[model samples]
Target: MPEPKEIGHQIKFPNTLMGLFKKGWWEIPEIMASSCLGLLGIGLGFIAVLNYVKNDGDNREYKKVYMIMRPDDPRVPRLKNPVYTQYKG
Candidate 1:
């Protein structure tokens, strides 16, 4: 290994690259590839989080079941509403 003073007063490369070289993160292309991939992942995660929060998250309006029928269809009998019975156990 060469002494720090032997190199020069200023580093030839960026600190990030130098630190990466020290950590051997550039052993293969995967780390470099992941750097780009990580940015993509961060973008996707941001979009997802934005969408969830945009609609007010868990407190957002939720649609319930509704009967779907056209005016052209034959008239149907009114369905009996199920009575809510209290459990007496």
Candidate 2:
């Protein structure tokens, strides 16, 4: 049995038009495809964080408004005797 390194080295490639250059991570087309996908994920993560922060600030503002409002705002109706009614024809 050949040594692992020797076995790995035994794989030969012809010096063709496509095989002239050495293979590296950046040399592979799949790396570029994955890089684009990673960039999109990073962009989406940034947008999500920005939205979360914006919504957190909005929540703080709404809480402050709620604290300052009067008990009897016409827009805020009180629920009295909450019950479910069934209609029969």
Candidate 3:
């Protein structure tokens, strides 16, 4: 029977700075694609978070001010025996 060949070829690491640059040229496209995709993901995530904050944040702030300024307004529901008032200081 024929003997099995060695599992894999050895990767050659460059010893000099110029050799390193030359060896790494093949990986430039792969690196650039990964960087672009990462930036795109971050930008989309930022836009989503900003949109949520703008919409929800404005509504929350308006409700808070309305409740404070017009507690007796017909739109505001009246609470009997509020939780905060029940607590003895």
Candidate 4:
């Protein structure tokens, strides 16, 4: 019987959106277009991530924060912060 083939690094390339957009994928026009789109996408993604991390979006308490302030609220919820609030979803 033939020996089973090795499964070494069968995946040769990244399949994610950003990963697929990496350099050397396109030939010319596609490369040109992707260059612009890819860079913008990367930049925007970075900004989004930065904004998320910067505003404590990953915090446990941040998720449970109230959307709207109640009358005579005693404390500030992370939801009170506009930038981080949108990232809840």
Q: What are the C-alpha RMSDs, in order, of all predicted structures?
A: 12.6, 13.1, 12.5, 16.7
Please provide, for model 2 over 1-89, each residue's C-alpha lDDT reduced to its tens digit, 9 standing for 90 to 100.
Answer: 98656433444445674453334232577875787799999999999999988655343322333333344665224333223446699
Give the alpha carbon lDDT tens digit for every residue of 1-89 in model 4. 99998875443546777656553454356766877899999999999999998877764545655455454555444434434334455
The TM-score, computed over Cα atoms with residue i paired to residue i, of candidate 1 is: 0.34
What is the overall TM-score of model 4 with all chains considered together?
Answer: 0.36
Expressed as tens digits, the lDDT of each residue in 1-89 for candidate 1 is: 98656553543435686776745554557776788799999999999999998755544123376454453545222223322346598
Note the residue pairs that clash in candidate 4.
Answer: none
lDDT of each: 0.59, 0.55, 0.61, 0.63
Q: State in Å the error of residue 72, model 1.
A: 36
For each of the candidates, give the backbone clash count.
0, 0, 0, 0
Top candidate on lDDT is 4
Q: In candidate 1, residue 81 scores what lDDT? A: 37
Candidate 4 off by > 4 Å: 1-27, 61-89
Off by over 4 Å in 2: 1-27, 57-89
**Alpha-carbon deviation at 56 in model 1, angstroms:** 1.7
